[model samples]
Target: MLRYTLMRLGIFAGCLVVVWGAVYSGIFPRGFGASNGLWVLLLALVLSAPISWVVLRKERDRASVQIVTKVDRMKANLDANRSQEDVADDSARTQGQPS
Candidate 1:
């Protein structure tokens, strides 16, 4: 997950640089005086989103699978613990042990 996050951030940073260059070269229009930086950032985000989505599909899927596997493992552990507790209780009852 962290790897995927960092990769996405790298894509965004790359897009920011490209957009910054375009704006400076007059290929893209700059924002109204006070909003120029914000404009560039937003444009970079918009451009980066699709780029990251397409580029990072495999990484995203791998991260998702890791998460799912971890969750399943945790669930299995919980089930195993519950079964052990049940066996302990049953043994105590059969032996007439106190509660």
Candidate 2:
């Protein structure tokens, strides 16, 4: 998870730097005195999504599988715990009844 997150962050930062460089270098026309900061960030995010999707496919799949496995394990543990509780309850009720 940490590795995946860091990789994503690195991609976003790279996109941001490239976009900023374009705006600073006048590659992207800036009619106003300074380029809009929010617009630049938004463009970077938009550009990063497809790039990340392609570059991080393996890491994304690994993270997804890990999530599914954890969920399945949790469900199994919960079912087991519920069954034990039900058995204990049944035993206690049977003991209280007259033989």
lDDT for model 1: 0.97
User: Against the true structure, what is each candidate's TM-score?
Assistant: 0.82, 0.91
Per-residue lDDT of candidate 1, residues 1-99 (tens digit): 999999999999999999999998999999998999999999999999999999999999999999999999999999999999999999988899655
Candidate 2's displacement at residue 22, Å, is: 0.5
- Distance from true location, Cα of 8 in model 2, Å: 0.6
After aligning candidate 2 to the native by TM-score, how far in Å is the CA of 92 from where it should be? 1.2
The lDDT values for all models are 0.97, 0.90
Clashes of each: 0, 0
Question: Stretches of candidate 1 above 4 Å error?
Answer: 91-99
RMSD (Cα, Å) for all candidates, in order, is 2.4, 1.8
TM-score of predicted model 2?
Answer: 0.91
The C-alpha local distance difference test score for the whole of candidate 2 amounts to 0.90
Q: For model 2, how does the per-residue alpha-carbon lDDT over 1-99 read when each residue is reduced to its tens digit?
A: 788999999999999999889977988754344547876788889999999999999999999999999999999999999999999999999999998
